[model samples]
Target: MQSAQQASVPQSDADRLRARAVWLYYAEGCTQSEIAGQLGINRVMVVRLLADARRRNEVRITIAAPLGDLAGMERALETRYGIGRVILAPFADPAGDPTKVIAAAAGNFISSGMKSGMTVGVGWGRTLYNALPFITGATLQDFRVVSLLGGIAAARRFNPAEFAWQFAELFQGEGFLIPAPAVVDSPETKHALLERCGLAAIFEMAGQLDMALVSCGGISQITTSYRTGHITESDRRSLVETGAVGDVLYNFIDAQGRPVEHEVNARAISVQLDQLRRTPERVLISGGREKHVALRAAILTLSPTVLISDEQSAKALLAEG
Candidate 1:
């Protein structure tokens, strides 16, 4: 009886250690080393205690903002578009940079949603690139990131491959990048590469993604797609002629959220819009007066689970008929 009582004492102490570790790490937001110092234990022991706490389901984190601030707009957007969650970021200057504000909010949303094992698909644009700096670093096991589009030949800050790689590094996860150019010479070439050049593996992975982070681009001279020379003047003219308002992943869409019929649609090398819609958690992060039509089209097309946008864009989206 004495031996059994002594053994139970260690187990009881372990429970206390795990509880303290969880409180410090999750509730107090302390780093592992800080927790170790506070508890008079080694960092490795602190790490184990936290892991054990997680295994015992002693830690659950939730992110809740005061909805009263943006509740009106959020409710309007949610009611109109059937969006699952709408996070409207406030800006001191309504005319200020929408990308910066939205990106910051998106970074928080993504960080909170992520878990130990998740396969995330990322799209590229200036707005998406802005989110990179704001993502918090973490070490997640079995985490993976896949670039949903092919790379742009020209070196640019917001390249698809670069964004995907950086996002993966933020979580210390594996990254799978599409090796082909953003646009191939022809539809046949796109099909050939996807069928024979091992690029199909990336697409297959995209199909099984747990979450997708994507942004839209308005078809304007200032838009990243046009400014980067990915879409030429003639391409723009032809796309407009076909009723394209904006593009998601280089796939042009009209006001009605249907893909515009154009040759560029066939030559584009990216995940299909329909597949994006099927992702378990689709997050659309984009805003700006220029993107009003484009953003509206995306909401109708993707039915994003979460939308991170500015107040102005939210009003503009609601104003649209």
Candidate 2:
């Protein structure tokens, strides 16, 4: 009689059974009818409950699918991140040369979007610098290209101006140069440089960019452009201490999407983060597991509309998250 009173209180036997059924089906590989029979329930009820398990979001299916199928992963990532577009380069060997693929993909992306009457902002980095040569001659009538960050004068690779010129030539538009070094000797120098007429004009142009092209750099002191003399050691240490993960256009941001504090950043000759955010379409092109942590940090900070990267980096990033 006491047991009968206890049993009178309703319990979700159906939900409990459904969860068990899913475990059996997925983990134990038991057939639906087998589970139903074992649980003393109707086969149809078992099927309904199994589906209900998914419908009510009780079970989350995780498929570690390869990024070789560009269409599905691209869509998944775009929807998940609320990004406008996602481009994945060819993964020839499933583990091929990342650098070459990044350059090729960037080249293809630039070729497709390099049109007339558009103001394109570009940031300096090796990958983006490499892609410059791949951009063949095209007539960019009335288009413009602006440097998103200041030019690299101290530790030269390829000139940011040259990269800007390539895009300008492709679109037959004007090339606006941000003539200040990416990092200055001091914050005072940065302020002075920003007030200069020629550089200020270019920075203004960058603020009005329609689209931007940039690459994410690594956090490693040894790997960073700053450590390589592209930017000073003091600047690198300061940025790191301020929680900067990596940079796109010399605008550093922390893990929680907060901009790092730096006196030089305010009066710097480079295009500002707020300016980049205001730009209608900021596109970032980058890849690598080494940069995965920094990439996520950048995404949180900038919220770029589109990203062009290879499979390895994408997988690494997704895994990281």
Candidate 3:
């Protein structure tokens, strides 16, 4: 008879390859690229093998190091920012993209703290969307998800409405999406939609959220907002000129975390910054050196009860103060 590990995996070459990949990832701490190089395969194949292993219940996440190892850094961030709590993911290399690790840490946080009968207001971004796969889903009664911002015409995977809907589906709960553009052509048009298009009800729901999960975006380049064609290059230049560092829920804000005086801010449709602050549990999940200024602004603006980020970003945040 075959061993338990062998029995779980098939006898095919592919299965054996996948098993090896799992060992490299979980046991040896080899990255996908390293595993691929060792196994004489492409990185994509290594990724697929690892993913398959995870699906086959062969992946067990054992915490080799405790989070307390970085307690000092975490505590310093919490004290300085006046955040209720701070969780940091280990990022050995400052040059590497820390989005995945930060998202994983945030996923663990949400999975552990989420309870039934809660209304959650959600913000959209690559980091937040990446957290979806890591969240532990359960069918809960009276659970609801509110998209804090309006949806875009483009059906991107990270669309605000898509994230809200998918998150709700995970819990088998109700999802409320604002059926309008995130940024309307004019403030008058924005008001008309909220008043006459029955979108006011969605914002009304957002007002009473038990928790708000949000992320910030920097104005350094063409990010999601610009990618969606809602913001032009001219707009970006103008925003930079106005001292805008980044945006929270599409609300362009300056370094001080105050909404910048811009036409974009006036026409954007989303929960007001002040109202978002009122949420009983406001969680901010974002990181990376590019967002250092924006993250600081978000903390100042939202006063988030919880902050999930990477080690390098946390250090930068502390050093800047």
Candidate 4:
């Protein structure tokens, strides 16, 4: 319910009546017939008022089911991470990989949560790529999608540009991408690409995104980051030795969520940490027992307002905390 104090001026009698009817119907569990009588309005008007409230995002309805069977853990993680919302997908095994389930959950959330006329930044991985089938595309207006990272060259499975382009296609929005390699030979080349070329402008656009969708990668296994051969096993070992837990947007970070000193981080072409944080609404998506530590670090580093994972991963996160 919106408080009268929240408004700059007093609400008109009609507006107040609408609020009262909404309160009676949704919050008070009153039937539309009952609400109509109390508000001295017809049942049809009450229905319209309730519809208006929901359309404005003022009244959200979430079934206490879904990953919600573990609602206690979801709430706890939200408090522990200072996150606004936590979403988890059910997994039969705590030790099993929860990528597909989590991806499906993330897909459902993205399909609904993303509204028209918003600029969104996207990060790519197997999880996000897998979410494609589950995601229901929509025709939207004034929507823009920005690829937060560079593309992997000759990558058969997942590439940043491919994901960004497909995601934009899903919403029929304009897509902005960094037309460069994900990792370069040297920091000097990275500087030249950002300054000399036009990629810096893309990063600048990303810095002020309305929302950012990202996921983390654990170092326990040679995942996509290593499988691509851009990040070698030796480099992974070196990163873990430097107290790195995992990477977000290829910015390898430690347990404290601080980027560790590494040549890989320096030469990687992607959105900067400062730019990522500048985005108000950030969503971090990843899950699995192996990623618990990395997920913890990602929560600290990204400070995402929303987190999506699996119940087992959620439990592991709470236990670790």
Winning model by TM-score? 3
- Candidate 2 positional error at 151, Å: 1.9
Tens-digit per-residue lDDT, 1-321, candidate 3: 233444565569667788888788767888667898998877645645654554355664433544547789999998898999999998878888889888889888987776789999999989998786566666678999999998788766678987887677667678899889888999999989999999999899998999999999998988664246788889989999999999998889999999999999998998989999999999999999889999999999999999999999998999984
The residue pairs found clashing in candidate 1 are none
Against the true structure, candidate 4 reaches a TM-score of: 0.78
The list of candidate 3 runs beyond 4 A from truth reads 1-68
lDDT of 3 at 296: 95
Superior candidate under lDDT, 3 versus 4: 3
User: How much is the lDDT of residue 214 in candidate 4?
Assistant: 94
lDDT of 3: 0.84
Clashing pairs in 4: none
Q: What clash count goes with each model? A: 0, 3, 0, 0
| Residue-wise C-alpha lDDT for candidate 1, range 81-169, written one tens digit per residue | 99999998875455667787788788778868888889999998888887754565577899999999999878576788878876776
Model 2, position 102: C-alpha lDDT score: 76
Model 3, residue 216: distance off in Å is: 0.2
For 1-321, candidate 4 gives per-residue lDDT tens digits of 333332433558657776787688667879768898887766656655654454445554443444447788889999988999998888878667788888888988997877788999999888888676456566678999999988877855478887787787767688999998888989999999999999989988897799999998888878564247588888889988999989898899999899999999999998877779879999999988778899899999989999999988887787873
Q: Is candidate 2 or candidate 3 better by TM-score?
A: 3
What is the C-alpha local distance difference test score of each model? 0.82, 0.68, 0.84, 0.81
